[model samples]
Target: MAHKEPPSPLLLVRGNNRRVAILVISILSLLAMFFLTFSPHLAIRHCGHGEQQRSMATETMSFSSGNTNDGGVSRRQARFTDLNDLTATSQAARNEEHVLILTPLKNAEAYLPRYFEMVNRLQYPHHLISLGFLVSDTTDRTVQLLQDRADELLNRDPPDDDSSSNNTRYHSVSIFEKDFDFELPEDRRHEFEMQPLRRSFMARARNYLLSAALKDEHAWVLWLDVDVIDYPASILTDLQSIDVDVVVPNCLRQTDENESMGYDKNNWMETQQSLDMQKKLDPDYVLLEGYFEFLTGRYLMVDMPTHLGKLDKVPLDGVGATFTLVKAKVHREGANFPPFAFQHQVETEGFAKMAKAMGFGVYGLPSYLIYHIMNS
Candidate 1:
């Protein structure tokens, strides 16, 4: 405009480069903003998908392990602060309580078939039940029979469809082999004279099984004898409904005739006479039940046939484990079947005494009957 010379080529090139740099910077800034605005939503969707997959896997793996002595507290157990809240209920809601069914076996091959049959017949959810067996000093094929039964139940195919009602698979099954070296002839096993030593050995076996098999996930411990043949399918829920720390049902010996006689005299209420006997006996003296030599005058559950109400609960000072259902916390809180004399009692009775000493209630359903196999 004022006689200016033509612009230099080098200067023109430098200006064009500056404009290009600015355009590139502007595009990069806009792309970063777009990613920042939407990244959180994508991240949240991915994280939720991962969590759902983990939950489903955990449910499928629950108690599928075999023969574990780990007894370590599980994450699931830690999540439960009060197991009583999960107690069995008759309400329409699902039953979340986990029950451990423990049995002590000695030459029990004959009973295993019927025992597992009875277990299968139970109406309680099998997925919520775990089985523990202690095969101590067995001369028969009890261990093999037990293993076969466990395999049959655990390895069965799952239901064909979600709507199928047949589900007999147990949550877990554990088989423990320990020899207590206690043996008696079949004919003389129940002799009153053999009671003390026999019960002492039994106490040791029970203590061993309890320690080896009990797990933190178990909400309840059910001591069911292998010889027990017949019970209501609702036995678990029925006992749990009582909600006592320790509870037992009257175990009656099965008869060819329809007569009902109490078979487990161990379920008794101590009398003042029994207390006096305990005070006079040596600290090591173990008391015997169902014998006349040491009649402590205790009230026996089997003797209470008149109280036949299914739900009638009677406070007990001693309990038999024939069909006992105990809150797991009772055993966790240091109540166990004493291998030694405890308050002049041993075995299951000693367990009751120990539980009561720990400030837990002991009870029995005097008229609620569970049948024991008839022994000749």
Candidate 2:
């Protein structure tokens, strides 16, 4: 048999090298594990499944959640296309059109969580919509809490598949943050002393957000404040039924004197005495064409593009930012929150007036009400 050529020494040496390679790999893997256990970013990066996976998960959850609970009531599972099935720019815009309720906030820690939870519990497709959160560089834990809740929303299960319950539209929540210009002192806010021109900073923030939200090409941008809580899942349903450019969810504010009333403008005030009287009635109240019970960025809706047209022509005044929806197309055309908007000057108001000049009508949804908790 020729003694099988006596196993080559080179082969033995190669075998030894393989063992050393394996040993080095094993050591490095252990080191990686050590870091992963202690470092969040490192763990997410090295694991190669950070934001990308979360985004995918969001899509999948949303897809599976389709019609699972029609109107927050359990129902049969409905067939649905995956997010990948969407094609064309308009398709993306349509997908985003679902609705984006933005909560413009500054120093709103105590009330932010409830606001987010209400959105989360809504009986509509939460996954179909995105939440734009405009936050001031906060001094408290509001931002951190938002970040945490955002993560939790992404990880949450799709609405229960059980057919017996009426809890359908609840899906995962997605919150996006854009840059906020927080140059205004809290003392100068509309709820405090009405410094007409000085309070423009908040408007700037709202305008910048409108620009950012339109960039996403959302169908509608729903604006809300951080403190107001009483929003029903059916709020969007009511707004979507209308063809108007903007839909404001009018609500009643529980006043210090224990009274509640409609929160939209009944008529424009011609005299300072009337305005002063209304202000005395409710310090933050601004008399418009009609008195709206709630408008202070608590919950307003806009069709981005149409609203953008209005912003381009002049400053739209007296329309509360809260619970309002605007068309996405109009918003994109208005120039995404152009710089110098928060000048405590006229830039922000200019956009609103521009919207009015462009002939965008603002409608009020009195049937829908959001509770306003004025903390300012």
Candidate 3:
């Protein structure tokens, strides 16, 4: 009889509320199970998309950062997107470019004083220029003289009032000594028959100096022969303005009363005869300019009239290192003076051939003359 009395209004209301709460809880549980079964695929898709975007961003960053080594591209190729960009930076910002001046010396004591004087007269900021020398196979006091002069040039004190004097000191000086153990009697050094052997040694010396002195910071390289007696103070600027990968001024022999004649025939353009002759010769046989034995009839830059404008440039197939200017990237890309025959030429001429083969322009300024001491 007491159980039958459970039909009270308050009790009925409480029972309905409990059933409603339980039904709501059961619906929520079913919804959560459905979400757990499908939501993992959606979450994975979103995360995968984000990961793909991050990978693409990382690859773009690597390319712009010049990390070409990882991509198998050369540093030289990565630095300039286009080869034509090898031209020097604007003249207004020329001081920003660092130039390495390299000289390969052999018994050059007699010329060091004049060479230093010429170096001192250069209008290019000395602080932007580094000096490098390779002393190879010498019997003279060249090393001592070079050391003494380097000391004087580097250690010279500037007058307190001269604000520009600090820029007169070279950025750095590096002297390297290595002997090739090859020698020619002084009297026969320039003989036609001895030129091949002599120049091969010279090539080895130049390569050694370049590899030793070339630094990542250098933008240009000036290969200067120590025997050059005279050049314009603006030679560096003049050559750079030509905007070629490799350029040389006409090398002339100094004569009494300042008259000059072509001294370096190494700078020449190949003639049909020369090419034909090269094909017939042994691959190892080297060619020579200014020699009667191998007459290929190549046109010499020296033969070009000197009355041409100083900045006037002509394409060259070969070049002499006597006051040559090269873009540093050219050497970095593997163009160098071959000690053996390269395209039937050796040393400086071989270097020109190599550069041209590598798709770089080689040129000469016929009227931009630099004087070489008369060979003894």
Candidate 4:
């Protein structure tokens, strides 16, 4: 009966209070552990810190998952973007244009191979070059050779670039095999005493070539002598870059190491003012054509404006066509090679005089020299 007695109320309440106290202490201990373990990590994230480490982790994940389809597609897209950039850059480098090269070869059989060499050496785009030949009264195989070569050049690309897509440029040949023989002896034919007749003949020949070769679509006309032995491959581009109305290079004839002298008398220039002054001093004064300084045998080389720093272009009363770059407009606007006496100047000199009267500038490069074939 004593063992079965009911428990006291105060004892029960005390037991409940002790259990509650133990529960509160356990909860406070759990909260303190959470703050201590995670507070540093949270602070670091909120303070914008450890960004480099995060980036490294992201890159590591990307590399580890690189075998995925998404990674492969991204890599392919980046490669395509690079290829597109390269193609755009290369396409911008093709600076193509139209140009005409005119040559008159009567007995140029010997020079045919060399002329082809010059053509091969030309740096201009092959598609942009239109070659024209004027062959008349030729006793040699010049006509046949020129025709065969022109056909070959037109039908196929140049020897160097087989993949070139530029073969549309047409080439032409004109043969006037008529005999234009003079009754004079061979020695007297090229004599200085008979210069007017010789120059007039030459002028007539030049005019015929110009009339036959000119094309309105051609922006420029390069009068190149087949006998030029030495010249830069960029000669055309160099002169064109000057952006002048008309320009000529210094043509030189080399005899010996010490005996070389300037050639192409037409390049030797005098201002109109000086020529007029000379005329005033002597009304009948004649400017001897092709005249040069004594002892040196070179034309009076004078200073002119610098074209590309390496080349200087002097204003001139006359110009030589041996290496002349004449604008097509100069001919289209009424300039031609005068065969008759123009102030006693004939042939190319007369052409210079004619061009000047027509308001065209004639310039010469003193330092930029092109060599002529010996005895040509």
Candidate 5:
């Protein structure tokens, strides 16, 4: 062993310590560099993935349903979006066209489930639409059912998905309930007195519902009758594209012959003759629908120059609000279902007159049909 002399222990220790320090520093530096570089890279990748997930989700998605059947008809998509905020903000968000589905619920328990099912099935993003219910004078489990649904909605988490930003929960599920001492024979609302006692109260009820349900006037108000049983899922999309001050989709009911009839009592093209005649009638003359059933027939036909190749916005004098879409400004400008007569019209008709007076275009979609549940 020609080691000239055993290297001094101190020297050896110092050399070893120096190499150890260098190695430790190198390892720590490598770790720091890796963390600084790769950590950000990982985080950026994660964020990008999240964003892509949301984008892709909204881009490619349909409904998931098939629980309830209508007389043995197997359903394809869930009748309603249920609470999922799917289609939270579709293309309609371009001009900030969100809608408040305002419903005045009265004795709607039996139909609530089906109603919601149909509503959820609407081909619009539930998130962009706030559901407002003014439950007045309901005796059945309508309020309770609404409460249960509200609780479920409140507790439901934003659906777990790669993309759920816009499709998050709804904007609001407001349910304002109170008792109105008024009573209309559940089946015969039209049969009862149609004057200050009946028609005016109906207007008041509608107005109250509007006041309570409308949350500011940033979005259009779609006064959807709770009794509507069937409607196109794309109803929202179709109506929004009409681009009018106010719009009403012709609602139809199935007659015993299995044919259809215009069910909207207030939906009509006011003729000057009808107008003058209406003026001559008793001040409390109730506006009756279906008088020209045989002449005009029922069923709206796609018969005018309109948009989307499947919708028409016909000028109207007065139409029903069975499924009316009123611009928020119309109400913000004091156009509402008046409790008193307005130009020989009352309630929804009066609302139309007010809108007209305000120079707001009131259009009707005749060909586009929505079904209403009768008795059942």
Candidate 6:
């Protein structure tokens, strides 16, 4: 049987040809499968087509993360050390009696320079006073201008000559720009921005500053508007004269009338100085109604040594927001007039009512009324 297997060479050659043909067919089948299964995927990956598709998708997202509630401490409020305790300790150790001037502003770039100039020109003891500027959303260059002015003030050297030499020295001026409504929704932005026109809102904003002023332990708190200029040397003397819980210095609102209408057409401004002038002209000016006397809007003084409880419940008239002073202790104990009146109510009638409610008398500091230029 072994001798029979080596009998033919032709038989061995045919068997080898059959084996080669089967191997060629298997290789062609594997190549066809590789092209069919992987070509499209490889092309897409090579051209970055998958990544391009991902890039074409668009999605928008908004985020809201900040202090939202304006009412009071929240349910989840953090436990922290009470500032009052620190304030008490600091108050005991304080040497210098400081005054805080809280000034609020909006888009008042054109008016702020004059206001700062007036404040700079003040004859009060600058070393004892500090200014706090409260600014809201200002679309214009008001904030920038204010910053520039602040830089100038920071760089200013003492005057070479003292025209009205007293104990007056330059005090510190601070600018606080808060975005009270910065995160307001697009639809609610207008409403939030306009809330200042409402009396309640104004009261709240002003009261907020009172807490801050108290925390700082200021000896006095003065509220001011950004539009008025201070009289050259009137602030210091005016502050020294108040003895009651609150003092309302009159203000002026300058008006222009056409000469064609005769004396009625004459331009006039009821200023802070004018109110003091009216009182000088008549001691019973506040008592008189429809007396046609102008009240000054540039100066107001409050004796903060007494209770500020009246501020919480009082309804104000159209009082000016300039040259008003109060005691820091009173404000710390939660005494503040409703701060949200548009323009003048809190400063006028609201201030008066609050004072009366606390069994405190209101007096006019006629001598302290600062000369507020109306047309400037």
Give a tens-digit lDDT track for model 3, residues 172-219: 899999999997898998788998899899999999999999987788
**Residue pairs whose backbone atoms clash in candidate 1:** none
**lDDT, candidate 6, 177-272, per-residue tens:** 665564334355234333334434445556655555443436666776675554545554444344344444444433454111111111122355
Q: Give lDDT tens digits, candidate 2, residues 152-192.
A: 66665555663443333423344445445455666655442
Q: Poorest 10 consecutive residues of model 2 by lDDT? A: 298-307
Model 4, span 140-258: residue lDDT tens = 89988987887777776455654553343344433443345634444675455666677677777778778877754566788888888889988878888776778888787888664
Q: What's the distance in Å from true for residue 175, model 6?
A: 2.3
Error of 1 at 309 (Å): 2.4
Per-residue lDDT of candidate 5, residues 152-182 (tens digit): 6556677678153333466678888767789
In candidate 3, stretches whose alpha carbon ends up further than 4 angstroms from where it belongs are 1-87, 90-95, 159-167
TM-score for candidate 6, please give it. Answer: 0.49
- 280, model 4: CA deviation in Å? 6.2
Q: What is the C-alpha lDDT of each candidate?
A: 0.82, 0.52, 0.84, 0.67, 0.70, 0.49
Model 4 ranges off by over 4 Å: 1-95, 157-179, 183-186, 256-259, 271-286, 291-299, 302-308
lDDT of 1 by residue, 243-361 (tens): 78888998988578977777898999988987877788888888888887777778898888655689899899998888998888888889998878888888999999999998999
Candidate 5 Cα lDDT to native: 0.70
TM-score (C-alpha, index-matched) for candidate 2: 0.53
Which runs of model 2 end up more than 4 angstroms from their true locations?
A: 1-97, 162-188, 191-194, 215-217, 256-258, 261-317, 335-352, 366-368, 374-376
Using lDDT as the yardstick, the better of models 4 and 6 is 4
C-alpha TM-score for every candidate: 0.75, 0.53, 0.75, 0.64, 0.67, 0.49
- Candidate 2 vs candidate 6: the lDDT winner is 2
Clashes of 6: 40
List where candidate 1 sits over 4 angstroms from the true fold: 1-95, 161-166
* lDDT, model 3, position 300: 98
